[model samples]
Target: MSRESGTATAEATPIHAQVSNLRPRDLLSKEDCLEMFRQVYLARYFDVRLIKEKKRGRLKGTLYSSHNQEAILVGALFGLKPTDWISPIHRDMPAFFLKDLRGDWNRPDRIGMSIEEVCAQVWGRVDSPGRARDNWSHIGSRSKKIIHSTSMLAGTIPVAAGLMYADRLNGGDAVCITFNGEGSTAQGIFHEAINYAAVHKLPVVTVVENNQWAYGTPFELGCATPDVADRAKGFGIPGLIADGQDVFDVYDKVMMAVEHARSGKGPSIVECKTFRAYGHGDHDDDRANKYRPQEEIIAGRARDPIGVCRQTLLDLGYISAAEATTYHAEGKNASEATNEDFPPEVVDYLNAGIEFALQSPLPAAEEGAMWVFKENN
Candidate 1:
């Protein structure tokens, strides 16, 4: 679908740009500021561990790590309330973890997911919440209202639309948000979903994680528009771009979009301009394909979300160098630890979860076929 650069139909109108230079205090409390850093570190460390597991052959099938794209997911999810629904992409486990933490405000007694549960899911053992029914990254929790993503790119955009549409029909204030890569934005589903959302005034927030490349293909070859958000004008909805590397920017823009939806104003698209540090998945090598330049990767790594956030905290005197190092080691094992920061006990707990999954039995084959409907018992 070639995106036309012009105004939307009569129903569409320009959504005002929120280019606020949000200060840390403006968006986060002292605890929030520190927790944000912890979440970034957790995402980075978890990804690194997954890569190691894949290399060691402990993890089967493909591995999609959101190594450098933590800020986008973390920031976006932070803006959403517990009642709001989310449809996550394959590389969006971090978002699920964050969502669980928020829990249902109405049911404040609900416990969020522990790090151990995430470890089990990544391992895809019998102990995983998916119960070996799905592969890694195709994660969902109905209790948490997260739509498990399918392997097809942009396949779930319409699903998010459906969820939001159903919510609107029920006179509910909930919004549904879906995550997609820049490459997926080129697909027909992306256009159809946005158009439907705009026409029906569905409270759906389509977050385009514009990580410069759609797998091996660069954004330039895949998308004609300079900014994916620019395509929003055609739909007559608000389109905003934010620095995906900067958590505050992502949080600020997404918060505004959430507000717009909750106020019954319709959909908004947010394009987070960021880079994917890994090569598509664990199997592909960007270096071998020469998909991205080594210099560019190095430069992007320099602006690592974890590092930038850590430094921000340090500069603001929110955390000392020693405390930051400790936070970095939270999810990593002792062998993986560096710079004298011993791995935290959570590492042992995660490993235990992995072992539990490994020791558990796979689901019965008959049980899988049983879920299908039958005319008669």
Candidate 2:
């Protein structure tokens, strides 16, 4: 030991301190961490499996997975009930599954989904409530009276607002949640949704998953504003920010925002800062390499949301290491078993969804030929 001979060395900043402002709680419990870890793991596993299948040419088209960005997707859905409705974009599948539909349950068929579910795709089977077939989207809340499906970017924002409006009109006590990517904030539709929701004082919560990418372009390149939440002020709505990686933080912020909207205080915009682990799609052969730097991707992996939450859970004694191991294994086994359950109808449903668009009569050739805006005509 040094006796006044050597000066004390300074230690690097602690991670908890570095992110003090981002968190929404004093301390995270082990169970909180474990739950977040499990949620993120399920989401990541699904994405990874799909990507693997795509690489093997098993998948016919793009699989927009939220691999690294699990925190935002699952975190916000924490403490959510089945009755609450959610609107999402394609990339937000984990949230959709955990919130709306259960891909986990394994029935005898194990092929997953029934012809009845398939028949609802955009064409609306007689048994279907919507009556139009093509209902495969994410999120299903039975307790919160929620809806399940994703909208195009800011497209769902307005739809969510409408749901809240309907609730208010019908004197319903439920809430509406809509999620989108950071880039969607730049779209005019996002503003309109917020404006109308705020003006009407609807019970809607708009969440933006800021993972720094929209399609091939990096978020920084596409988003003009430094903080997307700041845009909420223009609509006279409050803006909340949270650590998406930490599921607890997401839960806290979302719950608070939902309460604010439900009480007739208008809507809120929550920007969850997160990182995207996988590419926008499974196939990278034709990716726009100009965007998404590999260095950035490597740097982001250091703070895995699932790992962080697991550590917190361990610290809180919510779950033991052995239990975690078993938990994870069980989740994987369940997933493997689930794939078998989804047979012809699962694929058929997807196929039928596309067919709904295709089967619709094409624009009449004669009409197209006759309806041109030519000066000669």
Candidate 3:
């Protein structure tokens, strides 16, 4: 579905009354704040670029843009130690940048993919770890402990439980973070996984990004509960709802959950109340789409995640307005210049990646023959 980049005009910009007085320093250190801003900016730019590429017919497959939910992924992941594990769905692409990978699974906070790699991966380049084997969003690094996601609804929930169980067997204290949407909560697997995790006290955090709509269905129509977090009580585990638009609230709640799980507490559920700010994908025309109302879309844009974080950073005297503006520009310009010569490194990396992906041979015909499994014949 075709959709416009719901950027608010000066006169149309909604004043965010949701900004809280909680200081960033009180919750995050100086380094954490800086990294948070960098990832948020990068994710925003990456999202915008993906939209543009889809419009231009460059990116293939479904384009589920994480236009507004950057804070939830960033905040939840920032609190994770490198030794911890995370499993992300299609829209949680920004999370790939929060870690540092050094081929050492024992190391904490492994580095994530570079912007060029993410862009190339989305573009379906062979250089991507997926090797163009599937949709670009399915990328997972074994060394980094990122489990590749499937397109199935709530499919990974059970797999996340398995990871936690294995970790428990190995006597590791790391937690497993998995993401799902409000709609997925309706699926049977979601309930089964949560029930098992709760019974076992598995170290896993189930983050439900309640972006109000599950595909074309609104949360109200799909579920009777007031909030998705309430489902946690049924599982007998702690559940909390956080302002998905606010980074501090998300980070705070997720950190608390992580601590709880690390201390041998059962899994917890965190429902982030936010909006998708885009059609389900580029294939759905949001303007003509009857399922999602225009008024709700407009209202969602007013509480932009990046804008909220910028105002909070300024209010806390952590960063100047100029610095905030610069951060955005850096993210946007870097994304725009990936093909241009201005940023030689980015251009070079992207070009080489694109060339390798495009020129690389498709999987050989015989390669599939090797993966065959035979049951004692």
Go through the candidates in order and give each one's C-alpha lDDT. 0.71, 0.59, 0.69
Candidate closest to the true structure, highest lDDT: 1
lDDT of 3 by residue, 33-109 (tens): 75676566556655665566666766567777787888888878876887888888877876765554213322334
* Candidate 1: residue 84 Cα off by (Å): 1.4
Q: For candidate 2, write residues 186-261 as lDDT tens digits.
A: 8888888889988998878888888776777777687666666767768777777767676666766776677676
lDDT of 1: 0.71
Q: Name the 10 consecutive residues with the lowest summed lDDT in model 2.
A: 1-10
Ranking by lDDT: 1, 3, 2
lDDT tens string, model 1, 1-377?
Answer: 12332222222222333445443237577678777766666566566666667767777778777877888887888756667888888777667666745322124443334555566777666566677677776877767777778888788878888888887788789877889999999999899989998898888888889888787888889978778888898988888777788776777677767777777788888888787777787677645247688887776656778767777788879989887766454333324754333244334534565676567666777767664677585
Cα-based lDDT at residue 305, candidate 3: 77
lDDT of 1 at 64: 76
Candidate 3 positional error at 329, Å = 7.3
As for model 2, its CA RMSD to the true structure in angstroms is: 11.0
Error of 1 at 13 (Å): 12
